[model samples]
Target: MEFRHLGRSGLIISEIAYGNWLTHGSQVEQETATACIRAALDAGITTFDTADVYAETRAETVLGQGLKGERRAGLELLTKVYFPAGPGRNDRGLSRKHIMESIDGSLRRLQTDYIDLYQAHRYDHSTPLEETMDAFADVVRSGKALYIGVSEWTAEQIRAAHALARELHIPLVSNQPQYSALWRVIEAEVVPASEELGLGQVVWSPIAQGVLTGKYLPGARLPASTRARDDKGGAASVARWLRNDVLERVQQLKPLAAEAGLSLAQLAVAWVLQNSNVSAAIIGASRPEQVTENVKAAGVKLDAGLLKRMDEILTPVAMFDPAITAEASPQTRP
Candidate 1:
């Protein structure tokens, strides 16, 4: 596996990471989860990302059990705070109380003394950005978090945090956002802001939540075991008409991948990592076999011609500026 600096920090992370957003807690049993984590480690995936809100808070514990003993030492574990963990008024957002209280639980659940990176899951409209930054800075100061980052933040919000971190002399490392062949809003603004801020992007949804994998097809039923099949919350409904066209576009890439001697998945991942600014592509998988395929993609650097071919594959749809920016990408790992 290739390694990259985790957003200009001295800390090095694997080029392809295994994250537990859905599979560990929602889809797989402990046995399968153990195998998947082992597959990632064996493939040299050093990072494992989870969140406080995933699988009703069971993903972390599953990941903890999965990464026991000698294996734990080889991983850079990351988790996020600020989400509705419960029905209480104080159960969500980036309040200091929540931030402080949440990390301890995450640590315990992750079975670690310190998280390699801790991120705000989303932008909290109610909390002051400075307050959030100060609270995050404290996490680094207290040694509970090795680095601080934000997920799916707007360009302005990222700029605000970057400026505040500078004024306060706090080091903010990365921004996790959705970037894929099918979705390119980050290319417009967030990517530029992140570049200016000396922060690297560890992009999530690099495959458009499986759309880029060429799963759904025109005039076909939803795959019984995919994210789109599990979409009861209007997620699958958001791009009903557009998705068919996108899937058709993905089908065109199969021949390109065939000629390149790579799977379409590898081609998609390599396309995301093609940009120099990307630190790593977070690869989440349901089965252990998927980890190997995804990890190989990290090394499949696409040439300029291949990228142009890929653009032709997607056919340039209108940009997707998501509200919530990150949807936990449910079945995201699956």
Candidate 2:
């Protein structure tokens, strides 16, 4: 796989980075997780993304155990913070206290001297942006983190942080937002902002959490291992995702995927790579075969005509209402 600069940070990461979302420490057992990471490395995926809050903070330990020897140097390791890891009020957010304390915990769990990319998993509106920015600036300067990023933030908020980083002489490298054939909301604001600011867009959920993989077709039984099955959300969110119309659109991508000598997952992943704004796509796979399939997606590129056809099939909605924020989608239903 080719490499790209994570924003302007000078850190090189593989275009198809492996992410351990629900796989490591949640859905898959430790031995299985180890096998999956090795498979991704064998496929030239040098970047491995995980988070402190993923699997209630056990995922990092699984990754640490997997890449203990020569494998450690072969990767750009990433993990995130700013999610609730404990019941205490200070257990979350991007506060200085939390950022400082959390990195040590993450380092211990990830078994790394320093994280390649330390990101805020979500924006903390309650925390002062400057306080958060200053804390992150310290994370890099002190060598605890190589680079810093934020997830699910809007262009305006990104700009605010960027300016603060500039003022403080700190470099914020990238943003990890969800982008896929079915999710182009980032195209509305975040993409343009990131491009203009020289921040690379290392996107997550390029397949819409397996929706674009065409695995959940209309009338098909929900797969036992799919995110829908593992969803940690309200019933409303789950029910909306299971809608027939949504599944029909996902099913439409099957033949298109076959024509490309790929699975729908690959086609969906490749589609994200079609945009230069996308620095990389974080692909999380439950099994080694899924990693293999996703790795091949780097070789598949959709042409303009095919892209148009895809647009027609998925009917991509611009999710970022300038009136709304890039991090939060407009409410879909009551």
Candidate 3:
């Protein structure tokens, strides 16, 4: 797999990162999740991203078991905090207590002494940014985490945090945002600010949660066993893209993908990677073959003309409003 340096940091990561968000420990069986991880490794993926909040912390344990025997030095493991991982009031947010405690818990669950990149899952409005950054600083100094980042943070939030991170001498190298051909919210503001701040993007949902795979046809019934029909959070997460307008627009890109000799999913993933500031695209899977199929997007270059055609087809339905980033985050801790 091709690799890129995250932001201006010295640490390099695989372009296609294996992520377990809604699948492991929740939707998919542990055996299937483990097989997907193995498939990712077999496809030369060395980066893995997860969160303590995923499946109420079970995702990390499953991932740890999946990577149990791999050489730790060869993998770039990433996890996040700032969500309610527990019932207590202090069990969430980016408060010093949560950051400190979360790090240890994540390390324990992941079966690793240190995490390569520890991110704030969302901006914790209730906590002072200073407190959060200071806690992250301590986490790095203590060697529990090597670098720090934020997810779904606004450009203004990123700028403020970057200043604080710089003052504290921390390596705030990346932001994890939901970015895809159909979700261009990060392009307008977040990308420019992150570029200025020396932060690379490790984008998630590069296929718009499978909407861009051309599986959900317009005017069609919800496909059996698809994410749109999932009773779990997946259904809600993908609900916005299930509309006929969006689904119909997605269908127009299928031929473009075919002309590029890529599956719809590969085109979607490659579309995101075309951004020079995007260091990696996070892909989640329920089956091992899905992992194998999506990883082909890695190192695949789409011509400018094909990319232009893709934009023309998807732009009308794409969500590009910069405010969506802040709206997606909790105004107060959940």
What TM-score does each of the candidates earn?
A: 0.92, 0.92, 0.99
**Runs in model 2 lying further than 4 Å from the true structure:** 231-239, 316-334
Off by over 4 Å in 3: none
| Model 2 lDDT per residue over 1-334, tens place | 8787787667788999988887788788799999898898899999989999888899999998988884566688999988877778788888888888999999999888999888988777778889998999888899888788888888888889899989988778899987877767778788889888888888888877767777777887887755676555222334555778878877877787778788888888999998887779999877888898788988566878888888887774323354344435222200
The lDDT values for all models are: 0.79, 0.81, 0.94
lDDT for each residue of candidate 1 in 1-334, tens digit (9 for 90 to 100): 9888877788788878788776788888789999999999888888888998888788899999999785555678889987777677777788887898889889998888898889888888778778888888888889898888888887788888889988877778888877777767777677878888778888887777777777778778776777766653224643443356666777888988888888878877888888767888887888999998888886676778877877876746635564434343221111
Better of 1 and 2 by TM-score: 2
After superposing candidate 1, which stretches have Cα over 4 Å from the reference?
A: 71-73, 232-242, 318-334
- Name the candidate, 1 or 2, with the larger lDDT value: 2
lDDT digits (tens) for residues 1-334 of candidate 3? 8999999999999999999999999998789999999999999999999999999999999999999999999999999998899999999999999999999999999999999999999998898999999999999999999999999999999999999999999999999999998889899999999999899999999999899999998898888989889878488889998899998888888799899899999999999999999999999999999999999999998999998888888888888899999986787889
Give the C-alpha lDDT of model 2.
0.81
* Per-prediction tally of clashes: 0, 1, 0
Q: Per lDDT, what order, best first?
A: 3, 2, 1
Model 1's TM-score against the true structure: 0.92
